[model samples]
Target: MKPVSLYNDIASTSYPGRGIVIGKSADGSKAVIAYFIMGRSENSRNRVFAETEDGIKTQAFDPSKLVDPSLIIYSPVRVLGNKTIVTNGDQTDTVYDLMNEGQTFEQSLTTREFEPDGPNYTPRISGIVECENGNMNYAMSILKSADGNPDCCERYTFTYDKPINGLGRFIHTYMSDGNPLPSFEGEPTLVEIGNDDIDTFAEKIWNSLNEDNKVSLFVRYIDIASNKAESRIINKNK
Candidate 1:
């Protein structure tokens, strides 16, 4: 099936948060993809994705003023080999351990509760990386529901791209341009790693974030070259 584009999917909603992206870069060596989840509640305020030791981590910053730090911050998930990691907040570790035990995604996800937003606190978003013919096809979905809660049951496949080099670029444009969402204090950069060396890819993303964001980052790697994979979650704060 042809992958869906984030641009066309989110064009209808005027929500202040939420950025979607899907595309390839000029070199075509790596996929330039990304997506941002925003919220009207405290947790969704002034947040940014930072690179961590495990993977890309998320943190709540004070673009202008941080009313409360305890309520709206979270850890990051790392990307490793042949594994797709997805969760609401800090389920990275839980998901990783489960996968280690040969647990399915659905089984792992069922162990947690939706993020703590009364109305829209629990939107189940998942990211998957699949290996096919010496390449990885990536897809992520954020279950959008009218009721403001996580019902992985309902979803909108905003991004679906395979063997394309637009992963980061597509996400950059989608967040930076289309349906532009407010950014954190810094000019948060959307990054692309790997497509060359899995170790390098993992390292760059891991060392890219601040200590806070680095606290919890999930890692998944798809070794198309070997047709194998590995996934893990690092909870630095704990």
Candidate 2:
């Protein structure tokens, strides 16, 4: 599929819910990863991406204002060896734990499904980037309801081996805002991953997102040869 402009795709939607992007930098020197959260409710918006030892976790910007933590709070990004795992919910732990037990990324996700939120059944979008021997590969998955039917779950995993420079895949929880938010359909959108440093890349994504719905964003660039990473976090609350 032809790559579409990342900024335009994100700016076109008022609420994409949560999203994950994995790609290679234009210079082909760094492995790029981006994850962002957007919300329509108070509980969802009252969040900030806090840096953890391995990755980043969602925490309430205002502790007292947090109404429900069940679905709102989660470690969206985690690191395991040379692999980086990112997801929309607690499934991050599921992938991390299962993978620790020698399970593949796709295998680890088999034990989980879409969120329980009715009508919407928000899809659990996930991504993993692995780097070794100066080579990088990644995969993205979406565990969603079968056409909004809770009785069935549909899973899709897209793998990229030696990804092309300046290109990436974009996946999110919703297609757009609605009475009952619609789950994202089809494969992840092919997006342009321009040559930008961590800060510039983060700014581009943060600025493209809907101002009122976007909560927090995290962007990281990992050097394929050294396995070193540089990251940036942007939170609307602060």
Q: Candidate 2: misplaced stretches above 4 Å?
A: none
Instruction: Give each prediction's root-mean-square deviation over alpha carbons.
Output: 9.5, 0.7
Residues 1-238 of candidate 1 have per-residue lDDT tens digits of: 3344333333323342333232333344433333344444444545665666545666655546656654344443544455545434465666677767887554665565444544434444545454555555655444333444345434333334454453342221112222223221111123333253434433443344332323233334434556444444333423
TM-score of each: 0.50, 0.99
Which portions of model 1 miss their true places by more than 4 Å?
1-5, 19-32, 39-43, 63-71, 84-88, 137-238
- lDDT for position 153 in model 2: 93
Candidate 2: Cα lDDT at 13: 86
Tens digits of per-residue lDDT, candidate 2, 1-238, equal 8999998999998999999988999999999999999988899999999999999999999999988899989999999999999999999999999999999999999999999999899999999999999999999999999888999999999999999999999999999999798999998999999898888899999999999899999999999999999999999998
Task: Name the candidate that leads on lDDT.
Answer: 2
User: Ten residues in a row with the worst lDDT in model 2?
Assistant: 179-188
Query: Counting only residues 3 or more apart in sequence or on different chains, how many pairs clash (N, Cα, C under 3 Å) in candidate 1?
Result: 37
